[model samples]
Target: MTGTALDAATTELLAGSLRELLASVSAGGELGPALDALGWAEVLADDPATATTLLFTEHGRALVSSRALDDVLLAELDPALPPAAGSRALLYPHPAEGADPAPLDGPLWGVLLGPLHGVDEVVVPATAEGRTVLVTVAATDLAAAGGPATGFDLGSTWHTVAGPRPPGSGPPAPEAWTRAVAAGRRALAAEMIGVCESALTLATAHTTDRVQYGRPIASFQAVRHRLAEAYVAVTAARAVLDAAWTAAGGADGGGWAAAAAKLQAGRAQAQVMRHAVQVCGAMGLSQESELHRHVTRAAALDALLGGHMALAESAGAALLAGADVHPVVEL
Candidate 1:
């Protein structure tokens, strides 16, 4: 086989792995052990001396261990609450002399977090084996500790759950999770491609079946143009995603390529979903119809990694500054 063939094969394998890993994350399975076995864990794990770049909110804060550097004693607790009448309000509740923890349990976590993030909400269960905890870390406090008040390191917190040693035994190397995430993103982007195509197909089918004054609606110039645009957008998005996936297979420059893929895919997915909704008109928005479900899933997945515009801007800036814009994997 040639070099290009080898690269394509590697990408296919990585994409498959990514799809499976995403299914696992959604199914609530841990990947730490699997990653540790890959021999790349040390490279992926957090370095206390050097901070890592991450996609967290501007006012992010972390809850560190009070007992140990890795313990869950000090958690980053954000009390997500509903929007108050006539204004936005943040309920930063301090523990009363005898505050009960029961009120903290249940759907309230999700309820409070929903409005803050402006995305589909979820409440990670608080089970013994391992669960997400809420910690209240003040910006001032964090600043006083000699660091910016912006990003956080969740990997640091993972140490507490598994103790000084990392979790898992003989398994894939640590870098596996990074590769897995990249691959997973690519697969999801591919699924979005499938979704856009299906939506266009549905619209075309409807136009063909529904008659206007004297002929099929598909004969209308406006309908034809709309479908043509949808086709272009979906196809372009798919191409970017495929190229990004191929780039992600190599160890050299996968990060930038993955970013580009994510950015392009997200915008394309959103545009395609909106176009689908417009083409279907009232029927598309119906709760009973499967079209809306596909649209919703596409919109949701777009933000699964990060904002498309931001990624695009970053990619553009890097390019303008003469940074390497080529795909990392040599194919």
Candidate 2:
């Protein structure tokens, strides 16, 4: 099935299950067992006819689920895991400090960098002689030798994984890496859409209940306009993500589509979350409010896989290079 045609029932079921699983984990529960019980890893491991749909649905749900349960689930349910043969693999440029490189380490180290919270293992790519190889690294091994201490923040846990890598699959075509990065960009865009939606929901609910000057703040024309603007931005972001998701399934030049999707989604997420916080006023900034989490997470997501500006530049370069820039959604 195409990414756009993903069964709503199945999507809802997966979302609900993930939400419940994460809730249980957040309430002083073990994460690994919970995921294992839910067969999450197995589902990711299962080869699908349409990788785009699976990745988009699962990544989107994970983000939405994380909004309710917090960012702890971000790394645990990484859509990039369960590295498969012929699939795209992300390549890192350097090793984390204090971590030893693998025997086959090339000039560029294969690693996963950024807000890696609860991520046990990550897939890395290495290219040589026109072929790319995939490798997996465990988080524990990364920091085992006293590398940069793992740390957490309002948005996510920032950690760097490095060291010896376990061989994943045999080398694939060079283009496979590009495809994998594009798919990842699409998944990240999907997650950003969820973050924006969650922030908008919070802003809408807060304005509706908060009374100011004997009237609900939501009743004020200014507040209403702000919310309306945020809603439109979120909707636009979703549309871009949907188009990118569909394109990622099989469309030619999917990488360009994914880049555009990420650029637009990142902009929407940043704008919506900021407006959401402002609509909530001082309380939104308080630690007690969930709005802050959404804001911080959105900021972090926007920066992931290079920020919106970088993606925009990439897309522009591609267009200049004669890549077709057609609308994925036809009116």
Candidate 3:
């Protein structure tokens, strides 16, 4: 799902441009047209790793959600499939579900979760009886079947649909779905990193500005300790994720690599959120603060593809089963 390497300077430029664009879009702008005007499709064709990292990281920073994930998942699933004519969304597997859960499960999450805001149609990939079924369903139809769920995450552009799979079905090429899952896992991991990092940044700013007892909370050792730990968690997450990116691009058994990335990112998300909220106290829990957005978004993203505990347990099982353990970061 992730490949192509750009020189450092080029990557930096790309990151800058992406940040500017995403920041604008996050403020108030249309996602598809803005990305098209910026030639996002071309950039994706050139370097997927750069595209996923820069764009999704900004998505985390600005709390912007876009259908850009469709590009990542669909490209790996079936590149030959042409883009849809109308606005569309791709529903993916939810966090609670297993690798291949029931097709009609209530929570119809997506490969790239969120950014499912305005699309009228959706591409749902359902697995059953060892066959992969790709169905394009009307979003309105899903709504008619009970619409989206207003769950814990009110800030994210998450649409939880529940419905039946349309008529036709057949399995795709071998390992196609597996590859798609790996790609989605890595992409979500990038976004989670952005969310946790932004949360930490927000916490730091708040602690520095909010004063109590004639001093800023940030100056206190207790607050400083929490923020410091959050930083370390974020840094550790990014390190493992970079290796996953490398494994996905060139090395074999990227499944484990991607899993590792998501696992660490999930753990980091919880750590960052816990300390960030604690440092900000009651204000962090308030909807007025930006921390809650990251909090809820991280919750949903962590569950998508795989959660920290789920992946760790699975990783342990794989090791015990004698599966090839690709600790891409191996010494």
Compared with the true structure, what per-residue lDDT tens digits does model 3 show for residues 1-331? 4346677898788778777788776522356687788788777777777677777877777777655666667667654234565776666665567455345333354343443347666667776555666656666656543334357777555555554544544344336666777787788888999999889889999999999999999999999999999999989888888888778753333787788888999999999999999999888888889888889889877887778899999977877888655556545
Tens-place lDDT per residue, model 2, 1-331, is 3224335676567667766664454422234566668775545444222233343444333343222222222232233335433212123433221112223444334334343345454455555454544445454444442233233234343334444444444434345445655655666676777777777778888999999899999999888898899888878876786677556555443778877888888888778877888889999989899876777666666665657877777678888998766657765
lDDT of 1 by residue, 2-57 (tens): 12222445434533543344334311123334434433233223321110111010
Q: Rate the local accuracy (lDDT) of all candidates.
A: 0.41, 0.57, 0.73
Highest TM-score: give the candidate number.
3
True-structure RMSD, every candidate: 16.5, 6.9, 3.5
Residue pairs in candidate 3 whose N, alpha carbon or C atoms collide under 3 angstroms: 91-110, 92-109, 92-110, 92-111, 95-303
Off by over 4 Å in 2: 2-6, 26-122, 126-141, 145-152, 162-173, 251-253
Off by over 4 Å in 3: 1-4, 26-30, 79-88, 104-121, 136-143, 250-253, 327-331
Model 3 residue 314 CA deviation (Å) reads 1.4
Q: Give Cα distance to truth, residue 319, candidate 2, Å.
A: 1.3
A best-first ranking of the candidates according to their lDDT comes to 3, 2, 1
Better of 1 and 2 by TM-score: 2
Candidate 2 similarity to native, TM-score: 0.69
* lDDT pick, better of 1 and 3: 3
